[model samples]
Target: MNYTQNEKIKQVDEKTLVVGVDIAKETHYARTFDNRGIEYGKVIKFNSTREGFESFEKQIKEIAEIIGREKIIIGIELTGHYWYTLANYVNKKEMMLVQVNPYHVKRAKELECTK
Candidate 1:
């Protein structure tokens, strides 16, 4: 199902911990932000492996604990076919995963630069 821009924005709230990820072939980068887009921690680079995924989960749990948020929404752009494995892993963990459109990401970046 496709959600409108407003609908997507409504999914996140004060209790939501939003994570924006830049997925790559081997390593993926992620940063945690609040519902209002305030970043909470430094960027983390985790490899595409079981251990790496565990580490990423650990980091997310730690952040959630610190911020007192149980809901996590992970957003990632579909970079070729690299997201399937990670997406499956994330699904197994029961965390909410969202696929971001690359065009929207590009537009968001451009909008940010104008600010």
Candidate 2:
């Protein structure tokens, strides 16, 4: 997806989960942020298989239930066929899956290190 820099205020609730996921060839890495963009959990690592999906669903569901959330916004840095499986799983789970550019990841990492 084409991305352009834009400044806007993001209003999020305490239960909102903004997730950044790094999908690998056989595994994935994810970090979750709360409404205030605060890191509420540690980086979660899981495989890229049915078992992995099940585990992820279990943990995410538990978190959502505890926080009373009905929606999950997930982002991953992969495109085309590479993300089909993950996107399909997200869709099956009724979660919102968005394609994130790797450039954004690089920028975020830069911002994180400087902060």
Candidate 3:
């Protein structure tokens, strides 16, 4: 299902923990944050393998529990085909996975640097 920006924003509430992932060919990095954009924990680095995915899931769960969040929304950049396996893993776990545009991300970063 497609959601407008407002609708997507509405899905993230106080009970949600947002995780943004930077995808790569071998290793992936993740950062955790809350609805208000307050970051939590250190950057999580994991390999692009089943064991790595399992470790990533474990870390996410632990962070959510610590932060008292019941819902998780993981956003990953649609970097070529590097995200496919991770996306499937997230889907099997019944968690929400959002694909972000790389171009938009680059522009956003540029804008942030200006500010």
Tell me the tens digit of each residue's lDDT in model 3 across 23-84: 99999999999999999999999999999999999999999999999999999999689999
**Cα RMSD of predicted structure 2:** 3.5
Question: For all candidates, what are the clash counts?
Answer: 0, 0, 0
Model 2: runs farther than 4 Å from truth? 1-15, 79-81
Residue 43 Cα positional deviation in candidate 1, in Å, after optimal superposition: 0.2
CA-lDDT, candidates in order:
0.92, 0.72, 0.95
lDDT by residue (1-115, candidate 1, tens digit) is 7889899888899889999989999999999999888998899889999998999999988998899987999999997998888899999999999989999999999999995
**CA shift at 27, candidate 2, in angstroms?**
1.2
Which candidate, 1 or 3, has the higher TM-score?
A: 3
- All candidates: TM-score: 0.92, 0.78, 0.93
Residue pairs that clash (backbone atoms under 3 angstroms), model 1? none
- Model 3 Cα displacement at 22 (Å)? 0.5
By TM-score, highest first, what's the ranking? Answer: 3, 1, 2
Q: Point out the higher-scoring one by TM-score: 2 or 3.
A: 3
